[model samples]
Target: MPEQSKRLIQLLENEGPMSIKRASAKLQVSERSIRNYMRQANAKSTQILTDHSKIWVQERKPASLDFSRALPQNYRERSSYIIKKKIIEKEEVDLFDLSETLYVSYSTLKNDIAKMNQEFHAFQVHFRLKKDKLVIFGEERQIRKLISHVLAQETATHIIDMETLLNNYDKNLVHIIQQEIEQIVVHPALSKNDLAKMNLILHLVIISTRCQENGGCANDALALVFRTEKEKQWFGQLIDHLQTRLAITYAKEDLEQIQVLLAGNLNFRASEPSFEMDQKNIRFTSQILDLLEKRFHVDLNREEVKELFLRHLHNLNIRAQTGGFIKNPMKESIRQISPTIYEMAIVMAVEYKKYFQVLLPEDEIAFFAIHISSWIDQSNALNQKLKTLLVCPAYLNFQSDLLQTLSTRFADELYIPHVASSEQSGMDDGYDLVVSTIPLSTVSSQKVISLSPIWTPYTQQALSEKILKIKERKKGEMIRNHFFEYFQEPFFSVVRKTSKEALLHQMCARFNEKEIVASDFEKSVLEREKACSTAFGGFAIPHPLVSSARETKVSVALCPEGVLWNNDQKVYAVFLLAINEVDKRVFLNVYEPLVSLLSDEEFMTRLSAQTDFHAFSSLLIHKIK
Candidate 1:
């Protein structure tokens, strides 16, 4: 076998899978050359790979180690990978010898080892002595995980490379593994991107392959307590397939972990026979929908949302029972784009803790956010869209990008009727609102709202609010002036970090400085929150239990990071009410409509995207109206 062929095989065994483009780049060859090498690996080195040997056999296989290029530049760059491979191979190394190889002093190598010892120990791996030479020990399974994590960190792409995980860490079965997994899962609702499914499969391969190699027996660490009769039958069939196909006997724990991965990954499409839903899952799903309806006033009990949640909850509960995890590729995207949904996910975390007695990880929370975001999009689709006109500068700008973005985002909410350039300034187009980049004094038969060029979160909020206001005013219902009077924009702020009490104190201090509330306002608010959670759909409606403020005012804060509201809920948005005795009715009138709109899944999605105070206030008034 050629050196490239051996390298290709080794890479596949250790990493998992890679695209032809990536493999060519990693190997410093053309994609065509890589393919030829892959073919050679199968034909010539078949017996060598069967042994699962990590050593380079020069005669049997001419693919000897090319040390100079393979070894990374420095200890800082190569230490982890080198150490991991050495440990996996059970190769002992003396400090003095490693110092010579790495071109560093013995003391420096000692210090690096000491630092690494502390770090690897966290993952249940230990660097200790074996036959008077430093080597790695501890749980072999965890050691493999630590190695996988390190290699994954090296790649910049989202793809998880499968390194011969199924081939005893030696052969390529990327296509076969993917196909087998799809057949096994057979869930229709698998993520549209399929990255989530791949992630699930990658984790399973890592754990299962390592466990099997170690002759790992059944461990109850992550086994499910409850399973439908059908799930049990299905799980058994799947395990048998994996064992027979991969040529490894899976222990009870190995089978259980695979089940946990699949269960928590609710990417399953609906079943023909209707899944035997868990009783606990049904209760939890009902509670979640009930909470959404009570808090957001949106009925997500539709066939799709209900079915999706049940599928997700099936795994969520199992994860809740076993503390298993499923990586969400869209975790960061959901956090950045739909913070409100992310907070709702945190709320699920809190709620899950209440019933299941275990907290779901953020990735799991993001899985929940995926469902909520989808529901919001689908719900919004059924609503009436607003008509608007875009007014850009005389010169061509990035207006088309802005239009496409806004249209895509607020698909159901906004419809751009015409694109009017400021130089021409035609106002008779009869649009619901004129969103002008430049200030336009006159726009007959339409509302004119000047926006910034970048279409920042602030501008998006402003545009959304303008459309809502037009609709609200047509009802002869004045929700704007009262809101503008009570909710001070200067008092409003966007917080990245802060605790619940600390945030409350800060908001109360602002009100005190402005002479809007009494000294005990923050205390009373905390007490109220303790009495009952103020958070609903990621927004907390915390206020004094009794009316005792100087006036009826709302002090608001948006924390995208989400503050822990109590032991259960985390809130991203805060609405602090300070209502006086005379304005008691004002609280009921404003609070009811205010919380209802803010709690609305669609509205929260919109609000979380806004980046400015004007945009924030504009949306508030529109929703209130």
Candidate 2:
């Protein structure tokens, strides 16, 4: 059945008895297409029932179509289906016949193949058509890599898994492989997370399927030096089980490739190595810690933390080498909740790129951020407590009870050093935050929280959120203080919006005229921009890759019409930074917090909308408070 027809049937089954017009509108299809969908759906099965105006579904019958095995619906899916069959399965396909199966015309199918070939060019894989037969052209390693990429994306959401590939592999065989993977015992250090486990399972499944179909032809040149005897034993046992169940003898090259795969992805060596560390990773981890220490003014070179970061970097390097991409579902949350740590991870990624010439993915960066966040949490545990003032404004007994409740609830996070009556609230400005039972006119709303005399789960949740905001605001205030020192009135100006490069050149020239930066500062800034964009969170901070300035200064350019920083980002605020050698650390202190604070879309918009420097500075300082 056509994908549209199947979708229409499913929609009717879900929503139940929707008018034809409404169904057409919901699906974003024309009424005529809706009618055609009903006709096509009923042609296969009498599940869809339609009248003049409305469409509904009858009782679902024994399934005539196995929707579980998804038909190639869109271009991506269609390309994947073709690649899997013709390349991975090594099956010759007639274009006309395959096009009919996919419900796309032969010409459209040809166009898809062309586009797919273009997309796969970087992977060194291609599809070629001669006469009517479609064939794949690529080395075994490239072909396997492409296959891994496709399958990984297909199963990224886990909606499509081993069972979905039943069209190529036997149902019984898929089940056996899944069961074998489930039964396999891995080392304690190996990841058992859902995403990591799925990657291993899918890798094994693909190996088995390719070996079963093409036998020894699935061999590759990839190799790995097993760091432990346990990894070798595990690989041997896994291969033995698969060979016995699937009735195939693996080749020597295939065995070696599997060893590399296991060591890089499935073995404990990938994530948490108990054995001797790789010297390169040890150096990289040390350098990263040193950078963090120098940039953020904190030492994290303790042996325990060093070993942990070393293992993580070693595993990350292995993933880069082996084309192993582990999905991190918490990447966005991690970025938001601990953006300073995320920025630190980006620095690590930049250093890694310098060493290996490979840029890590966002997920990997996020994983590194988690490690750094934990380290920061451990190192700062003693000093991270929030200094708070409690204002109960009740009887002595009730005030003591309130303090006890707060201490019991937030002992680790909050340090209630002072207690003030409602009348004394205006007199104290020393506390980081004020937790009061009554609203106060003196305290900034950002620094004050009003709660009921009685506490509940709702109160706890609200207070926790307020505390997080206070911490974020405190960070912003620190950055703002360092920032305003370098932000001069003479350096601030309003400019007509222009191209990113043009605006950057203009600003660099202005800085050069002021003799604040080196002669080649513009070149260095453009080089840095080329390496990695500085435009983020609705603002751009362009600076030299290596700082060499006569004086540390930040030139502010307000673009009311917006400057096009890249294809995706347009910015109204540009902070061109020129940092002297002595001020490099100071620049970094301002950079991370500024990025985090500007990540708030509302705040960025409000700050960028200011036409004058005074207005922008005032609004920023106000927001910080």
What TM-score does each of the candidates earn?
A: 0.25, 0.31
What does candidate 2 score on TM? 0.31
Clashes of each: 18, 0
Model 1 TM-score (2 dp)? 0.25
In model 2, the runs with Cα more than 4 Å from the true position are 1-385, 389-429, 434-456, 472-484, 512-524, 544-552, 560-562, 579-625
Those runs of model 1 whose alpha carbons end farther than 4 Å from true positions after fitting are 1-476
State how far residue 205 of model 2 sits from its true place (Å).
46
Q: Model 2, range 1-625, lDDT digits (tens) per residue? A: 9999989987765444555767888899998999899888888887776543235666421121222334668876787667755653334578987876667899899887876764565456778888978877777656655654554332222322344345334677678766776666353323323433444554455556656665544335535455455555676678779888888777654565455445433312222334467888777777778776555434341432554456456656777998775665456554543434555566676677777778678778766765565455434332356878888775745675676567546755676655776646354476787888877888877678889878789999999999888777766766676656678887887878478878888889988897777689999999999999998757888888876776678888888778888886788888998876545654665667667767888888777778788898887767664
Q: Which candidate achieves the best TM-score against the true structure? A: 2
lDDT of 1 by residue, 147-236 (tens): 444433322122243432343332443455565667765543243425346555665565555555566565454445423443456566
lDDT of each: 0.58, 0.65
Model 2 whole-model lDDT (C-alpha atoms): 0.65
Lowest lDDT block of 10, candidate 1: 55-64
